[model samples]
Target chain A: MTTTLGRPGTRPSAARLGLYRAAIELKTFFRERDAVVFTFALPAVILALLGAIFDGVYPGSDVTSAEYLAPSMIAAGIASTTFVNLGTGIATDRDDGTLRRLRGAPMPPSAYVIGKILMALVVTVGETLLLLGIAVVAFDVRLPTDPARWFTFGWVFLLGTTACALAGIAASSLAGSARSAGAVMHLPYLVLAFVSGVFFTPVGALPGPLITLGSLFPLKWMAQGFRSVFLPDSILPQEVVPSWEHGRIALVLAAWCIGGMLLCLTTFRWHGRRGR
Target chain B: MTDTPAVRVRGLRKTYGDTLAVDGVDLDVAAGEVVALLGPNGAGKTSTIEILEGHRDRDAGEVRVLGHDPARAGLDWRTGIGIVTQDGADLTELTVREAVRHFARYYPEPRDPDDAIELVGLTGKADARVRTLSGGQRRRLDVAIGVVGRPRLLFLDEPTTGFDPQARRQFWALIRRLAADEGCTILLSTHYLEEAEALADRVAVIVDGRIVAAGTPATLGGRATARTLVRWADGRQETDDPAALVASLTRRYGGVVPGLTISRPSLEDVYLDLIGDPS
Candidate 1:
């Protein structure tokens, strides 16, 4: 047998490998019906339910309850798709030996991370569209006509999803097993949604400390940024600060993205907690 | 560099807190050779293999795989090694072909995914989802993924642990085909004495993190040179010269020794003795 020694420049480029990883990631993700329903449909269901329960428009604004909720739920949907989905999904991978198998292969770790984020991006987009459709058709919420609002929607979606996805990757390492990951990821997400005024109308109505606490995380700023895009400026006085803090929202989400990346780098484990 | 052993280790040691898992150990596997690490549970077989695979860090060791220290080896080195771990990846949603093809992309030069599936006798199951495969078929899929990269060295960590008798034999045949066709160096770990004897060119018996004996199946623990038992209908005797004892017994019977038998120790006996297991 001939030995082939030191074959240089033979590995597929990292970007190409990442795309392959993403392809597999998406394929497997969509096949799991439970995951699709839980990750993609749960937020939309919550929005529909909330839209039905809350009937009145805000005290001084023409924006109905459903219209106010439609945008914030989109933000929550992003968190669900990226943060909760990735946290549990990565934990499941670690638990089920997928990460171990990948680690054993010649594929770069960065490719695996990129694949997961890309899968989240695809799922988040689908989820956002579903929620928007439900909001507009079922609850009579209006789509944004202005190009500037759409532009705000794009950057907020991108930054918010990136930040939450990174946080999910970082948090995946905290779960001891796949069974516990749902709890570990959802507890913080639900709490943040409440304190961020995702379930409530008018962010100013939330307790001062709760709002302050929510501001420290990405979800609150993400919800606020989305509200700026969908809700009319007349509704701006209902905000805690009475103005759209677009710059602060971008800074916070961007910072979380960087911070979350660092956390993932420091904490990511390719194996289960007791694997070694 | 071509002459360097596919795997070489000296003074390999690892510990978990205060408990030493792998103590001072030395092993070598030449290219194209098949070596089995035979040990019972908790005997450091996994620790040593994982260390060699670069999946686990060693507390102290000088180890080289494919002519490079696994600890510092890059992707090039990784591409030359394939690992079939005990627990296969959960690719339940993917068809066997898809899983094999997915892994094939990781390597620069990979076997055709269909051919790899054929090599592992999984062509019929190629289109089936991984979750639908039987235990034996799932393990075969793991082998397909491992070999798709065309690795120069393959590490199989107890590949047939839970296989039935027929499945075990089939898996052994698959492994033998790989050794013959691919000429790849294989380092397998297993606790089954029969499995080690069947698949290994050389068997190394590990006990409590140390190699107690290492040799071919017939000669392990000096079994080849050990006293043989010569038995007849009336009596039995253990002697160094079994042939001479049998001749004497035949002559005493004046033609043939009734119910006569001559045998050396079986590999199981030698292994049991080597591991200090009375049972």
Candidate 2:
């Protein structure tokens, strides 16, 4: 029997509860050694490698390939960790009964959703910063000085991160177990990175069909946004536009973000397959 | 309202594909009562409990838990109910104390995390990660999480399935405390007849989604009034009163009857009979 008398219980506001859960999730994210390396270290390593092979200026462009690939890789890393990682993690929780427990608790379902989004965003932002640091040091890529470009990059980052995160959440329903979740989420992530021109870009010289196909994805828009910031004005002729395609990129990424969120809200499976 | 029971069910029904999981069963548990739902596997115990816990949608019939229809109840209503599911969910990389503390935040009136852990006799391993705990220990953790909310109504689905005898006894004691001290109403399902007799104020036997018998353990299926058997070295008699039969047998032997035994049917016997033969 409990010997110490407890104080009268107090109910935490829903928002407070959500932030608390998010805090714990963030802590767990860092503590899980594999996840930390996968989300944070793996991208930096890949970026460094990409920076090595393609760091020099492109034949038709003034900017080194690192300046171009930096943002694309950043987008790819965010997509992999936030979208794919969250997908598998959610699936594992479902398979293992965490979702069931949460469902039964007094906490709101939104609290769980909020916890995951916050976790994804926190890591996405952190990983982006780390990738930026590497781009600066290893590849000598410089941060954009123009306030206008920074503003554009900010919204592009937000839209792209959330779009991928929502897509991952939506895709989790397709997975029956954690093992299957990896393959289910990985396919689209890899496909998007490749088709979006995140890799092998200087897209002007690429096949017109490929560039058109890549333009449809948010990853491509995110990459273009970064290029606009890092590449000089002289590189405009080979770009998607003379400077930044801020309006078009924002429009596409935002549309994807809204569509993905709606899909997740409608189709997301909160419980495990066992219930069926 | 004080008159309302902790749980009330009327014509509860559920189905999985073509099979009925819970039939038109009616049950009621008064406030502060410990009611054990006893049945074999696939007997609809889990399905019924899940519906009552509001985790599953019932196909038909009316059900109320903690005075609200669980099917439509909101978080305010859920604040008073606790469930320790059949399978414990493993929270990766969190210590016992941390997990308990984390779940405690989800309730309106939660017990102190440390106190809840101690109540489950897990103080020794408070800091141990949940994955490292033994099966029994993790089960204890599950119970701790369930009770930390200080729920007015607690649902335990085969709570002691993996427990050793000592742990089972300890669990029974903890549940007794929850009932006796906090007036928490408990609805649990169990396979062990002893667990039913030791903890439940009443036992309800279910078979094939129907309650075949329900009463206090001694009186379940009229077990208390059932005939007793008196046996001696070479003779046996089924009678209402075994003491009189034993006395006559002693007199026939002009002393203590050799190999004398007065026995009545065990709860398990009546249970098997009610549910049909187990073998």
Candidate 3:
């Protein structure tokens, strides 16, 4: 006997579904005026304010304080787009029944994940350009012309964003509601910014214990990697170590990529905590 | 198999910590039949529907939907089902058309998004942001998304809970069309007796996590054989044959039978009795 229901047809490929999901995600993200402004502008505004307040060059280097901050702020900006935005955005989806609707559909879980990460990537790229424009215009920070430097910048951006995006997906489960997601995401992000020297110059100036703690996380390494691409080598002495520590940076960020995926697999929930 | 039921459950049970949401329960919905799971709040209606929709796990049960166990069902099984949940997602940032079109992509064969909007009577508001829609319009949008996939079996969980009287009637018409024209099987859960009476080919009354009664609207809880009351201006009596009694009363009253009326136990009365709700 044969069933009359459910016609036989090939499902849309996962890649095609992922692209569709990404389109919807991007459309939703950009349409929310307040979220768009907050996510894209907050880091740039902070960089501008810090650039204006700190007027002098760092000791023994031609780099002004504003120039010193440009690269670090880019790293922080990436964190904002991937980690903070994704964490809160996912929590809001849970509170509003988005996950329930998605779960009910025939779409694959991987497609959803791909959509979110791609949305973050597109937003982060725009955000990076915005910051780059501001740094060039307001802070006299030069854009690197060397192909090798850009090559370094490319890898760091991809790996750092992936790691942070995964971590954000894992962290989203901690928020009890959409309303509380802001606090849940921001508290850790602000602390990481301070400890990772996104707010301060010269990582060596921070307390040794703080440096050690920061080194264990991806944010500190991301900032160092960005600094190596944009800032002069003469400014390297101010780092916790005299060199860029490129090998360790890669290892730490890559490890975070792996560790974050594990955490997400263990902790991610499609439904809100209150849901059955 | 052609004779296989679209949905089947045996000894289904679920618990949330200390509270039992669904006790030992059995149900079956055959292909092309529209069944309503009628129950009040906390009656395990949502839990049972969610389990069948593959959105929740049951503590213990044998369940199958569309020839596959929902607990382990794949995407193909999901493609056969449409669900209109109690509360829908707030897709506030998306326009109504965009939301419908996006969901349509999830299915292998889907109705045109514009056609779905038209079917739900939201064609006028297709381009409006979802946040701008009124409560009833949003529910209509939910229905559009639910049906866009052209599902073979549909689950509507209190689809008209917050709808006004007119909106409820309109929704009922849409549901009737789907069942009659498309031959779609439906299992809808609602606490509204009137809704169940209006839409269900079969109604199952659930109380305290168990089905207490199940039958056609007229025969549920022995309603068909139940006595009817015949009343006149001066007197009333319950009898098996209301027509005969009314004739006798008309003769005794010399033709008109002043203020004569005859009534049987209504579906509401049988339902109230089944649920043991005195009010």
Candidate 4:
């Protein structure tokens, strides 16, 4: 056989392999109906449940509960796409030896991770749009008039989901099994959502440390970005309006993305240690 | 002919923390010559294969595959080799053709997907989902993917581990055809002694992270010309010249030697000895 490097043969390209990896991920994700229910349906269900329960009850004002719940529910939907879907998916692939199989292939390792992150972003954007559609048609929620806020909503959701998915990938490597991945992946979402005022009125209404601590994570800033678009300007204290300082949110998320990328590069196990 | 060997591994050493997985091993496979790496479990076969496949690194050694050091070889060098592992991914939802075509896109001069399927005797099952195929059929599909890109050098790591007896014979024929017809250099690692005898032009016996012996199956462990053991109803004898012994016995018996038989060590016997079985 000709051992020459540049013989007349088709060699593996990173771009083509990336497309194949992305297709495999989508097919696997959709083929499992239970995964579909949790990743796609569950987030929508949570959004609708929150919208229904809170559409009419506030302390003194006549604001509908759906108006209060919309932003936070959207934030929760983003959380599901990034953390819950990604963490469990990567862990299961590792368990099943799928990741190990890809290692020998010509597929670039970074492409595989980036493909999953892109899938998570697609799911989050789809879920957010679905929640907005429900808010407009079912609860008489007003659409934001400023197009710049819409741009902010799009950028925040994309960046925030990217950050969260990176965290999920990093967290998935921490667990030894898929079951543990699910457990660990869910804990961060629950704690961060509650503290970030994702399901509540505002962190200002909560304890001072709660708001300060919430600032440490990406969820609070993401939710704040969402609320900035829909909430009336008077409702937010001047200090909390999505200000130039909010750029720090992007910086924090970028740091997490870089940090998570490093952790996954270092510790991701493609196969079982036992070689089964 | 001063070009580097197709694969030259010299004193390759690797330790997993405290355990020495591959300890000071040396090997070479000339271009276009099929060499079988034969060993039992924990004999460092997998570690050696991983290092050669460029999936794992060695602690200290000089190693080369297709003229470039695998440890530092970049994307272009990696594309020249193909590896078929023991098991493939669960591609239950995709038809055989789709899966092959998807992998084909990764390579620059990939053989036609249909041709690859035909080469593996899976043309009839091209549209079938991989999960629907039987064990032997799926194994053939795995082989198809490995050669789809027409790799210069191929690595088959326990390629037929789960094949049934009939399937194994057929797979052997396919491997021989690939070597003779396509001129593809093959490195097949297997536990089956018969497989080594049937397909490999040369077999290397690796034991405890070292290559103990390497030669044609007949000559391995000097079995080709070793003393033959002859047993009769009344007596048994061992002789280096079995033909002369049989002739003398026939002359004394005036026609036929009762219970006449001549036996030499089988490949398995030689392999066991080479591997140094305590039992």
Q: What is the interface RMSD of each candidate, in Å?
A: 3.7, 7.6, 2.3, 4.4
A144-227 in candidate 4: lDDT tens per residue? 889988887777776778777777777777667766777777777777777887666655575678777877877787777776
Computed on alpha carbons, the lDDT of every model, listed in order, comes to 0.91, 0.83, 0.90, 0.77
Better of 3 and 4 by lDDT: 3
Superposed model 4: Cα runs more than 4 Å off = A1-3, A6-13, A93-95, A199-213, A234-276, B1-4, B90-92
What ranking of all candidate models by DockQ puts the best one first?
Answer: 3, 1, 2, 4
Q: What is the lDDT of residue B104 in candidate 2?
A: 91
Candidate 3 C-alpha lDDT tens digits along A1-276: 245445556778778999998999999999988668777788999999998987887777898888888888999999999999899899998899998898898989988888898899999999999999999999988989999999989989999999999999999999999899988998888888889988876678999899988888899999999999998998887889989988898999999999999999999999888667
Q: Tens digits of per-residue lDDT for model 4 on B1-279?
A: 225477899999988878887888888888788899899988888889888888787899998898888777765665677787776656667789988887777667788999999998999999998889998888788788878878778888877788889999888888898899888888889888888889888898888888888889889878888889997666889999888888888898888788987899888888988888776
Residue ranges of candidate 1 with Cα displaced over 4 Å: A1-6
Candidate with better lDDT, 1 vs 4: 1
- TM-score per prediction, in order, is 0.97, 0.94, 0.96, 0.89
For every prediction, compared with the true complex, DockQ reads: 0.55, 0.42, 0.63, 0.39
Evaluated at residue A73, the lDDT of candidate 4 is 70
Query: What is candidate 2's lDDT per residue for B1-279, written digit by digit as tens?
Result: 546688899899889889998988899999789999999889999999998999888988888787788889878777778889988655868999999999998876688999999988899999998889877788889889988988878999999897888888878888898889878889999878899999999999988999889999989999889999888789888999788787777788999789988888898889889989755
- Per-residue CA lDDT of model 1 for A136-252, tens digit only, reads 899887888999999999999999999999999999988998889989998998999899999887678898999899899999999999999888888987889988999999999
Ordered from best to worst lDDT, the candidate numbers read 1, 3, 2, 4
